[model samples]
Target: MDFKYVTQEERERLYNEVWDEPLKIVAQRYNMSDNGLRKHCKRLWIPLPSVGYWAKIKAGKKVFKPDLPKVRGELKRYVHSYAIKYRSDIDKYSDVELQSMKGLSLLTDGTIRYVNEICSNIEVKNQLRNPHNLIKQHKDELMYRKRRDKELQQASFNTDYYNITKSKYRENKPMIPIYVSEVNLNRAYRIINALLFAIEEMEGFANVMLDSGNDKGYFVIMKTTFYFIMMEEGKNKSKNNAEEHVPILVLSLSAGDEYYKCTNYSFKFKDKVDEPLEKQIGIIILEMLQTANKILIEEMLRDREYEREIKKKERQRRLEQMRKGELEEIKILQQAASDWNKAEEIRKFTNQMELKIGEIEDEEKRHKLSRWVLWAKDKADWIDPLIEKEDKLLGESEYIFEEIIETQ
Candidate 1:
């Protein structure tokens, strides 16, 4: 299904095919559309059956078949594949026939060199030498758990075990997960040690933390942490329905990291059929570093964008603050203008009162009225913001937001 390799499907073969069965059936076999196949037959000089040819043949009537015509140039033969073929002579083919020719290519030299550079000097040895301290710790923990399991099993057989509480068989906690069959554990440890070494070479740390389910491997670099998982093909049901572990160890390595918001990029390396897991360590390292390089580049781009967004938002925040202060200042100016107008009105009223008080015949009453008018003028001055005359009860500080209450 991948490439439908229908090779040498030329004029004579195509002619026989269209005549033998429906174009749709032939198209399905060749992984092509019926209409596209019909056009293909036309260009290949292969004559097709008329619309009612099948019906006539079903009725036991004789049908006419045309002879295949000869094509001059590159239309003589056809093939279906990833690439197209043309004859050695290019000048014989016209523009229309030449259009069918296509070229295919492989990985560029630069990409090959990049992957090779990352994978350089990386390999899994026959045996691990002085395994990393963390690996030793995890190995010891596993041994302790195995012994505890055996103890728990023996205790289960004893009648007195029921008298004891469940806390007696508490399992030792695991560290730095290394999941594999006992047969493949040593190999897995060697591979992991190489992995840890690679991380150290990268000037990054190898860390383990429970992430999402049983996955515990993590690689920290450039202030970013990504999940990593190296697992052997376990006892799994095969296509034949037999459940058994693969005799040859096949390690599958996968890794992923968050990009923007909820987006994640996951990279996986498949096991090579002809080679063992130990032989492919360099290629695995290549894949890992290549994926990391791409992710780090993306992180750099996103960081720049993030910085731009922060600056944009900060500018917006400052503008909002400035607008708020401007509104408060405008309100203060408007309120001051209103109070000044009211103060001028009050002063004019007191002046008129003073003139009226002069007309009184009683000197004592006149003096008392004049004193009242002077007090009224002083009240107006206290109310005016520009004058800011302080009242004995209010002190020097402005209390514009509070109302004065007269105490009895």
Candidate 2:
């Protein structure tokens, strides 16, 4: 195993992630022993979280981050070696290793560039004034919920939200709702449309479609179906009359058909509505591509490691079978004790073939060698089979009594 190199940005991300959780939890993610990882951190001058940092946060108290130290010389990015743990059933999977993150990053970069080009050339419609009507409906539902805090009303709101806003890519192809004021929705729409176009230009991603209903849509990446969605929460009103609607745009990468979560993310933002449409959408696309890249990389790494383990197990199985064959040969030779030379020749040939089979790396070659080994085994088994004659010879024993009388 080789150490993975991390860039400055990745280092920062890892540092933040470690601080957000316990050391043991973070160590497990990188396949590192906890104490070993702690020592690595010390050697690298990477600061660990304070003893009670997580405790304070859990208790709803304010906590601050420790400043990263300045690098004195050439920076090191070497990570601890990652090992794939053995599992009895690992050989069942078709793919052994997942795609490499390096390759994925290249794809992501291409997608981002494509999206950038699309965004640059395309006209982003002013959709705020004619904003999706579902925005108003969501607001109405919110108002209804505020007046009557019942579960039924909440469920209705949730249903409306999903139906009108989220299921644009389903088989039924439902009607899309006009949600959010045109001002709030246009930026999201423009960015999403650009993303679709960029996905079209990129390889390994296809079946890209935007839904007619709402802002929910779906696409395929690396053979997996993923939903890209934009949802708006109703406006919030403060006593001072400050009003704003929070619109969330996300790509859900999950396992279930009905329930998916936006777990793999590159960037998260706050108060993005105030940003320029191009900047906002560009940033979103960048992060989205990054997230997709990471997912592909993880899948590839898993597949690679899995395949490696499967090969290892196969090698072990072959060796065990060979050992069993050798033991059986030994038993047969001991029984036909008088025909040692003939049996030895057969055993020697079998051993030679077995060694040749082990040395062959090409699978087809190994298979051929294995067939030859089987042939040798069959020849060895036919060495001596006159069990009745051998028994008669033992029973005859005529000279034994005469030798005893002469000795007397």
Candidate 3:
């Protein structure tokens, strides 16, 4: 019935008995105030199931949260892909044509999917058609030449030697009338094709110039570079009848002025190059200049991309290292926390033992000396000072008890 003097075991049994009751009922049964009951529950490390716990049980699943919506419409999707596919044709088309194509449904996602499907079909078709046959057909002439060369090698030694030496000399010869190798001729053809393509692409007024021999003859050389030559003839008059003369010949050269050095190739109108030809020349020169410029730009862009990739990798590595350091720091802090908790527990237990010692009555203390003896038996190093003080006090009390006994 005395709450203040209740033993630990009795308090534990009382707590277990009333734990399932309402707070008021439990407090009344224990003859304690509500606040005191609450304090006791807290000290015993008990948790009450609140509304939040009931809500979780009712829900039966985790709650869902949605992320914020993203902003759209910065760029036109798939425009780059379309541009790359039709770059050559697009470059030749007028602005009006480009606009017309831009308005088409190709920009839609459905159209893109259809286009991809078509491309895949085309690839499969080409694969099935054995497209390598077309390549072999194109190289047939080169193969024939190689076969002929091999046959010539198998012929008489003197004939073969003479042919090989003659071929070598022909290869080295400048402006030789002999038939040139097909490979060199092919290269020249490709160059001429490129020049013609440029001229046509520029609408015929290529900014190129040509030299003329006389008013009657215009000649252009296409040896090392392209040139255009023009010539006009003087009027021939009979019986006082005059007529304006037309240019006798208009010639273009894929080769330039570097080839012609003969005085016989004298020109009359070296400065009379067409304005269109001048423009073409300007374009060619501009394109040549831009070649180096393009290369420099591409190299710089590539270097920047590579540097960005390296920086990204380095950042990732640094982040991983930082995470590892943070984990290590957390582990160290957790260990320190555990060690502090254990030291606190030990201090609490020591204080409890000290309180128990203080609570003993004098006669009870003498009778319970055996209990203290047992508690301090193997822990002499820890309780030696306290035990010595207790023994001194007890000895004086015993002498007083003996004096009272004698007086009685």
Candidate 4:
């Protein structure tokens, strides 16, 4: 009923794991309860994590991990159970469960350290040369918007241009989501195309989501869906009589909702004084990808917990159904009545066979037919609970009514 790790190597591994994350986490990985794992560690002379160890690490503070003490004296001689079984435990499946638990030891600090590890071989170019398909589509849409705006601006006495412009912005083929001025529209597309290519280079897919009539940037990276948005941040400038915001690209990432522990992160980019946005595009994509990995890990944990709950509920439901099926008396009577009806149908069919057997002229065939009719009548009697007839192949008459057996 229990699994023990008296060996020094096993104890060391578990000790390192507990110190690496926390007792609660290593317990989950080993399919052991928190208290149970703690007790085993104590028995094996393994060191446990100190209080506030994980918290201090999360807060970016220095933390200490004490080395595990030697497992000597009584520990070397005696080995307690590695895992204790509860009342409903089935050890036959322990190997399968442990196999399922394999590779579950997730890195505790990985989520927070995601951005730091994302600085890999990714590049973002400044100029847009042979852009992505989406980039080309948006570029055409941008051109259309610009030309339409110009036509509407120059139409002083034309009411038709005003009417055409009213619905033209909304009905553009593959509507562009960027809200930058004419001066920066092309620049935005180049930056976006560069990021998309950079993401693709790093084994990720980047695309834009058309929500209703607006554009919402999203990408498929690490098998997780992340929503990103790009906006122009700048001071207003007067071009002719109309005022426009100067072009400065700002990018942010978000995914899921509040229920998913929704991740909302912004890249550390503000102005052109440091460098062009294109140069830093690779890091920005990495940051977004890191957050996606975080969300993926969180969702996996939630799903595992949810599956456990579902299994527990399903077991309880089966137990309740079993008890209910045993206690229900009317179902038994209904089953008996149903069997009686079937017996009568069989008898009726046998009667028809007996009457039809006279039409057969062949002697051997007629004899075989008559014997089958008699066997069919015997089967009908066997099926009738009141008659209590024993059948050869189906064994003896065990019950007057077996509703559950019939249903099963």
Location of the lowest summed lDDT over 10 successive residues in candidate 1: 79-88
Q: What does candidate 1's lDDT look like per residue over 90-191, in tens digits?
A: 445444444343321122344345335545777777888978766887788778778777766777776678336336655345367666778778877887
Q: Quote the positional error of residue 78 for candidate 1 in Å.
A: 67
TM-score of each model, in listed order = 0.54, 0.38, 0.25, 0.47
Best prediction by lDDT: 4
Off by over 4 Å in 1: 1-118, 159-170, 173-176, 207-215, 221-229, 234-246, 252-262, 294-317, 388-408
lDDT of 4 by residue, 1-408 (tens): 234535344666777788777778888887979999988877777777677878888899987777776433456444421211112232243433523532212223342243234445445555768888887877777678778778777774678867766656556564435667767777787777776765554345666656886777677755666666655656534354356555566655666647565554444454464566767775676566555555655566666778889999999999999888766656677777888889899999999988899999999999999999998888888888767667779876535745446756
Relative to the unseen true structure, what is the C-alpha lDDT of residue 235 in candidate 2, on a scale of 0 to 100? 34
Q: What's the best-to-worst order under lDDT? A: 4, 1, 2, 3
Cα-based lDDT for every prediction? 0.62, 0.50, 0.37, 0.64
Q: Rank the candidates by TM-score, best first.
A: 1, 4, 2, 3
The 10-residue segment with the lowest total lDDT in model 3: 214-223
Candidate 3 ranges with C-alpha deviation above 4 Å: 1-289, 355-408
lDDT (C-alpha) at residue 11 in model 2: 58
* Candidate 2 local lDDT, 44-104, one digit each (tens): 5679987888889889999888876643333433531111111234334344232322323
- Give the per-residue lDDT digits (tens) of candidate 3, residues 341-390: 55455556655666666667786774575466545442432223222223
Segments of candidate 4 deviating more than 4 angstroms: 1-121, 153-170, 182-187, 235-247, 258-268, 272-276, 329-408
Clashes of each: 0, 25, 18, 8
Inter-residue clash pairs, candidate 1: none
